[model samples]
Target: MLLREIQDEILRLKQEKDIAILAHSYQSHEITEVADFVGDSYALAKKAMTLTQKTVILCGVRFMAETVKILSPEKTVYLANSSAGCPMAEQFNKTDIENLRAKHPDYTVVAYINTTAELKTVCDVCVTSSCAEQVIRSMPQDKIIFVPDINLGTYCKNLVPEKDFILLDGGCPIHASMTENDVFKVKKQYPSAVFLAHPECKAEVTKQADYTGSTTGIMEYAIKSDKKEFIIGTENSIVEHLKYKCPDKKFFPLSNNFICGDMAITSVFDILDCINGKGEEIKIDEDTRIAAKKCIDKMIEYGG
Candidate 1:
């Protein structure tokens, strides 16, 4: 079957089944094209809450689908590709964070939105890559314990230098793998292009970027900027998406290794299968959901 045929079927079935589809920015263009909304995980989750559909499908990873369930508990949420799971999200578990909390009793616990919903239950606040700096700065605490993604934690810590941050050894393997040399090579290849990186990247990599932001933030910046060329430092898919969005502008990947295998695993077929009731349904206990929501609610309060 053709790609468009499957997507058309998915569109027809989702409407027939009263389902809303949320595709993350990292998802394939075909999946995003058919989605009701396409953006980052937290934004997608918030969008789900405003949606009228009783059921939703997230064409992303497991934790992203879990976030949707946490936000809109009344709606049924499914991960379009059951095996698509973010390695960074699973890097730190509930117990690991609990142990850190025990050691830093006076510190505020900030969980990145990429974390498992279970981990958020123990967190004081949640933040996305776009709002981490602002959220951390807004906190009244003098010290903070950031979990799961040390790279993002470091990036935020640098932005809000007044607060003491305890960063552990955890991050997106794909982003962490990039080095200063990779940035230099890319910059050399495209001297005229501005470099935009995601905060999940290593400090060395992010420091070299002309702009560091969330996936959506990077896209918006590139679209609005007058620059004719850009080297996207996150997932390779962004380069492709940007090319389609701004045909006149040239987009290059900072490194071919920037491709996320987890995000790549999902396809339009997964969304079709999900809408047909063949995907993994995300489930969380009432207590866990409520507890996890507090952190996210705090994010909205502080980020706003």
Candidate 2:
């Protein structure tokens, strides 16, 4: 009946049932502890596709579970918490992308991986925060329509100043809300600590960072870097994970307000309930799966 006992049971059940648990970096530490793999959204989905598990419990949001289903249509994908949804993912829809495409016939649409499957259906290619810069720079098109996250699009554009990017008016409200003052305060508090930021943050916030990257990239940098302290400019959950990963190093969050309530809503209990057959399972239509796969496959082919 205890939490430890439940976790043990969940792990045992996962092995007995051939289920792979995939946790996003923004998930709680307890959830990550029980997961088979924990990383960024796209990386977690890609890893799920390669696993031989018949079922995958995605401890993230609705769109993330849908992404796993899109990648591995044969496997059963379940979202740990059905209520957990990304606001940014919900900001754009199929009609929105179609409308944009109609207006700009000559531009190639590059969607951020944090999107609904329906949105992916209309995209020319998909990109993750970590690979967006590289993928966009490698594309043949001179004019790019980066969607659903203007902050990330701007970050990519800054990396490739020669290319013209049409950024959509959508972004993570949590990260977008972060101001230059937050960056200044963090810097002042930890003068020696290196500042690592996520591309989802505003341009001004990212400009003050020592390094800008995805959530996974931030974690990797902190682990590999020689620095003893770091100021993380992303979701607060990441700071929690970093503390456990590197107990010797000091990690400070850019702002306490930079929290994704949706991402944080899912916990180990929800994941266990799903594995026990009491949670909602993510089901995608064959057409949507096929359509969504096109953009994701293109992303893997080009971004890989």
Candidate 3:
């Protein structure tokens, strides 16, 4: 079937079957085109929970799909592409966190949302890229151990100077690879454009940005502001999303090399196949689900 035909079928099936399709900002242009909602991971998951749909198709990475399952366990959640897994999310498992907890008994383990459901089970609280600093700072504890993203942990440390934090050697390789030089080059080319970056990026890149936020936050900021041009510092797919959402504005990529293969792997065909029940459905054990839900729920309560 052609791309348009598949998209038409998705629209028809969603209405006929009470389904909702959620795409991440990093999804392909075609996938985002047909999605009911497209935003950051936490926002998508939270939106999925409030949705009245019977089934949800998450067109993102494994952990994002798992987050939908975590929030709306009653609603059937399907991953558009099972192989689309985040390397940062897979960095720390339950065993690793359990060992870390044992080693640092005095510290509270805070996990980034880009983590497996099992890892969340071992975490004291969960945080997204947007709320990590706020949530971590609000905690009463003096010592904290942040996992699965060293860049983000370092960013948090910079924000809360008084607190002691142990940063794990894990991060999004794609974002970490970006440097201040990329921001400078983009600024030189697009002097009029505002630079917006993701906090997962290295401190140097983030420090140079005109504004730093999560994928969804960046979209909202660009859309709401009168700025006609912006240099987006996340995945390349975001430029596609912004172009669609705000046609009047010009969105430039920070660097041609800044891309998340994992997030970009899922295509519109994968989403259509998932909605048609040919793709894989994410399933987690009840124990893992319940335990993970605790951490996620705490995030909703405190982090929100």
Clashing pairs in 3: none
Per residue, candidate 1 scores C-alpha lDDT tens digits across 1-304 of: 9988898898899989999999999988998899999999889988999999999999899989999999899999999998999998888888888888898799889989988888899999999998888888887887999887999999988888889999988899998899999989989999999999999999999889999999999999999999999999999989988999999999999888888989999988888888889888999999999999999999888972
Question: Which residue pairs clash in candidate 1?
Answer: none
| Candidate 3 Cα deviation (angstroms), residue 19 | 1.7
Error of 2 at 275 (Å): 1.4
**C-alpha lDDT score of every prediction, in listed order:** 0.91, 0.90, 0.88
TM-scores vs. true structure, each candidate = 0.98, 0.97, 0.96
Question: Tens-digit lDDT track for model 2 on 199-278?
Answer: 99999999998999999889999999989999999999999999998999999999888789999898778878988888
* Runs in model 1 lying further than 4 Å from the true structure: none
**Per-prediction tally of clashes:** 0, 0, 0
Candidate 3 has its poorest 10 consecutive residues by lDDT at: 295-304
Measured on C-alpha atoms, candidate 1 has an lDDT of 0.91
